[model samples]
Target: MWFKHLIFYRFTQPFTLTADELEEKLTAKCFKPCGSQDISTYGWVPPLGRHGDMLTHSAGDFIIITARKEEKILPASVIRDALDEKIETIEQEQNRKVASKEKKLLKDDILMTLLPRAFTRHQTISAYIDRQEGWLIVDASSHNKAEELTSCLRDSIGSLPVINPPVKNAPSHFMTQWLSPKAVLPVPFALGDECELREPGDEGGQIKASKQELTAEEITGHLDAGKQVSKLALSWDDALTFVLGDDLVIRKLKFTEVIQDQLDAINAETAAEQFDADFSVMTLTLRKLLTDLINALGGEIDEASRGEYIEKKILEVSKKQQTAEETAQETA
Candidate 1:
């Protein structure tokens, strides 16, 4: 119902599916509980809380989707204890020290047996499709996790015209300019009292200064002395506050007290109505702040070479998957 983080992607081409159409497509891969012997499962869930079977949640042109991934949480220590005890018992009975390969096989057997009875943990990530704006906003802090959502989506709908959206201005330069401001500050944005600065390179020189006014001499001195802003905290038009990273990941999100107070006034007679209202308000706030942020950063980049970049990123991810598979095969 409430989203805390975002990883955004732009639709490089037109996306013309309606909510009903989307639901029909996604229903093919709707969430299923993990089997007794299964390690993990990922699929779509109803974004409209406990009431609906449909996966897509719509607020005007925004079509929201939630992904639930459940995985068994078998601890390594538990397995280790069981394995050590078994090894000791075998040694006392009829065995010498177990070979390393034999020990590994025994551990694997134990894990497979324990998995059926192991406790499971589930996490749901909410995402919204801004069809009108040609962007998909996923509630994820990691690029890999966000891309997992994208992969699930592509599997569901057959195709998606998405790529990691690029901002025209480099984040470091943009933040430095905003902090010192030789020119006027970007409209609809204000600096907050938290920042992390780093000297650029592999040497790993950095400073984290927070709760002090960013404009003050103490803070400005770091910038003047030879540090570039790697991550800076910002307040967005009193609706949301977050730390913006140089890679454009938004973290540490807290809705401003002002927006919450306004939201509190919109009481609904029914639970469903309340749920709808909450999502609508949240989605609108994100849309406004992100749209403005994108605009201020010279809007989304539309270069001829962007297609090549997207293909390269996809290839990198593909290579990672291939490498992982090869490693697993070798290990096997």
Candidate 2:
């Protein structure tokens, strides 16, 4: 999987360098000769640091070097002596290049800290460091001890600043794809386990029915009453009743169409009223009504004319209800 990775770092003081300039400086300073071998022959692995600043490296088994902006350079001799005393299989050339790269990398990339984790599992770490702009990116696959790794690196480097990469908000089980077949298999069930089982026609048994055999009549009662149905003017009571009943789905569709029509009518009226009166309020009302209609239909209404009509209808209904309540209170 391709991950969106970032490097983070902090500086004691601010320093400035363009991207190209920083890159060039790091390449020059970090790449050094090993004995008589040409520096070019040695591998000059580019430094990876957080926020692209703070070059870092495993100086030896016991030491880590973290260099930042304006920090004094640790002498090559000091590094050589430390490695010879502590680290085994010391390659003079490789050690020099590694140390040089650690310092130079810190000055190239700069960024802020976002996430930090204890290094407890990795044996080798990928270090990213940029100091000029202030960033450090570190990925150590070798160090598995988080506290030991972090503490060791911090202690040896004189602590200019250290940062960890951001914790990704990735889905759990993201590595499911990488799991081995054996690891992914389900556990075997033993015989005579207490799992639920049933015979045909057993008491409290699971019920099964075919969709083709299940008719609407079986679910809902027959509506054979010879009652006449008539189309009625739109009202809040009727609308609410439809919404809270089985007719809600069909009613919603019809209501949305009706609201659209109303919006069109309002727009036409507003255009005509532009010469006679202020239709601003009416326009606003219509817009609100259209919005409600769209909401009722679980859709979006973006047209201004439609929104105005919807708003007007909603306000009119609200005012009517308020007036009715006031009259009832007066009578009481």
lDDT digits (tens) for residues 1-332 of candidate 2: 00011122333233333434434444434423332211112212333333223332321111112222111223456555544443333345356334645533432221011001111111223333344334333332222322233444444333433322112221112112111122221111011101111122325332222222212232111111211111111222121111111111112212234434444555445433331122232223323433343233334333454446455645764696699789999754
Residues 1-332, candidate 1, lDDT per residue (tens digit)? 77777788888787899999999999989888889889999999998768776788788988889999999999899999999988888788985888888888988888899999999999888889988878898888888888779989999999877867667678888888787845465887888888998987879689898897887777678888888999888888877889888888888888878777877899878877777788888888888888888887777667776777778867876898899899999988
On TM-score, the candidate that comes out on top is 1
Cα-based lDDT at residue 147, candidate 2: 27
Task: Superpose all Cα atoms of candidate 1 onto the true structure and report the RMSD in Å to 1 decimal.
Answer: 2.4
Q: What overall lDDT goes with each candidate model?
A: 0.84, 0.29
The 10 consecutive residues of candidate 1 with the worst lDDT sum are 176-185
lDDT of 2 at 27: 49
Best candidate, lDDT: 1
Off by over 4 Å in 2: 1-15, 30-43, 46-135, 142-332
Spell out the clash pairs found in candidate 1. none
